[model samples]
Target chain A: MPTVYITAPRDVAPEIARTLVEERLAACVNRLACDSVYRWDGEVLTDEEAVLLAKTTDERYAALRDRVVDLHPSEVPCIERFDESDILDAFGNWRAESVGEG
Target chain B: MPTVYITAPRDVAPEIARTLVEERLAACVNRLACDSVYRWDGEVLTDEEAVLLAKTTDERYAALRDRVVDLHPSEVPCIERFDESDILDAFGNWRAESVGEG
Candidate 1:
């Protein structure tokens, strides 16, 4: 299983996160408010954003990613994958069950 | 190189992030406000927290982890390691140099 890390516009992230959970692509989504600093057009810019950590199984990752691209307003969305190196067994079970996995 | 994922009290997160950056334990720390839901002592609880994503190198991770543990007030702090699966070359270079890895 992997947790997908994604950054999206602050105004748009909540709905997208809810959609993923409602559609069963993720067991749950953790949304966080952030200020993302990056270099764009040769200038450093800081923009308000949200980071979504979606707990999902590997089987659903591709679909989750595609849906994010479909919903995200950014032209080049920031999506990163992280393997769960360590996790509490009970929480893992809960997450797996929530996602309709074993 | 890896990004350390840690959770802290919302009020304490900012200072911890700043200290890590100032002490060179991390090149930068991304802070985000979140509400974490988990089962504690047979009760499900949701607590407002801050997520600290600390960018550091392999050689520096142990030190970073120790520093985070020291600063975190939680009896058992949440600190997870994530290897960079893929990153933009220029960004990677900057991150590496920022942490004194390059």
Candidate 2:
């Protein structure tokens, strides 16, 4: 399983999260308030962003990433994969059942 | 580098996050509102929890995990490691400099 970290505007975060679950692309999604600081065009910039942690199986990861990119507002969205090395056994099974071939 | 996933009581989440950054155990921490559903004591439990995403280097992970265990209130805290496979190059360099040698 891979947990995807995607950042988007705060206002649209809930919609994106809801859509993922509704479409069964993600088992569950967690959104957090994030203050992002980055360098853009040779200047420091900061923005209030929402970070979405989407849980999905490896079989469904490519689809999840594609859907995210399709809906994302940024031209170059931040979609990073964080591989699951340690997770609760029960929770892991729950996620596996929640997504894919459903 | 690793991004550690931690869950803590909402009220205490800030304290745990602050300590990690202040002590240089983590380069930074992101706290998000998480509604967790799990089976506990043969019953499904739903909790309003805070999820902490702590970013740190491989060299500091052991110390960071030990410190978290020491400071955490829960007997068995959820301290899972999510290995970073994709990340912005500049941000990766920044994290390496932020912890474990200063």
Candidate 3:
């Protein structure tokens, strides 16, 4: 299974999160308010942001990524996938069911 | 590098997050408020929770996990690690420095 981490501007996170869940691309989306610090265009900057941890399986990752990119506000959004091997069985089953695999 | 996901009640998240950073077990921690649903004791339960995404290197994961478990309120807290191979170099360097690896 893969948990996709997506960073979005605070204002737009809810919409993006809703779309991913509604489209069945993700089983669940955990939205967190955060401060992102990074170097962009030769300058280091920090901004208030929201991160969405989207739970989905390998089979659905590509679609979820595409949908996130399409709905995101940034030209090059930070969409990273972390493959997990130790997921709890019950949570995994729930995720599978949510994405129509179960 | 690994990002450790830890779930705790909202009230305790800040203290746990602060300890992880202060001890240099994690470079940074992103705290997010969310709902967690799962089966416990043969009953499905839902609760408000805060998740901490703690960024650390492989070398520090064990210590971080131990510290988190000690500081956490739950007996068996959710402490999961996701290793990353596609991390941005700049961010990785920053993480390394923050954890005194640089």
- Highest DockQ scorer: 2
- Writing each residue's lDDT as its tens digit, candidate 1 over B52-73 gives 8887778789999998999989
The C-alpha stretches of model 2 lying farther than 4 A from their native spots are A41-43, B1-4, B8-48, B53-79, B83-102
Candidates in order, TM-scores: namely 0.58, 0.61, 0.60
Alpha carbon lDDT of each predicted model: 0.78, 0.81, 0.80
Worst 10 residues of 2 chain A by lDDT: A86-95
Give the winner by TM-score: 2
lDDT tens digits, residues A10-96, model 1? 999999999999988899999888855443343334577888999998778888888888898866676667787788999888877
Tens digits of per-residue lDDT for model 3 on A1-102? 888888889999999999899989999999888755443443434567899989998788888888887898776676667788698999999998898433
Model 2: how far residue A96 lies from native, Å: 0.5
**Model 2 chain B poorest 10 in a row by lDDT:** B37-46
Model 3, B1-102: lDDT tens digits are: 898999999898877887777677887677777799999999999999987888888899999999998998789999998776455445567677777432
Name the lDDT value of residue A85 in candidate 1: 76
Q: For model 1, what is the alpha-carbon lDDT of residue A37?
A: 48
Compared with the true structure, model 2 gives a TM-score of 0.61
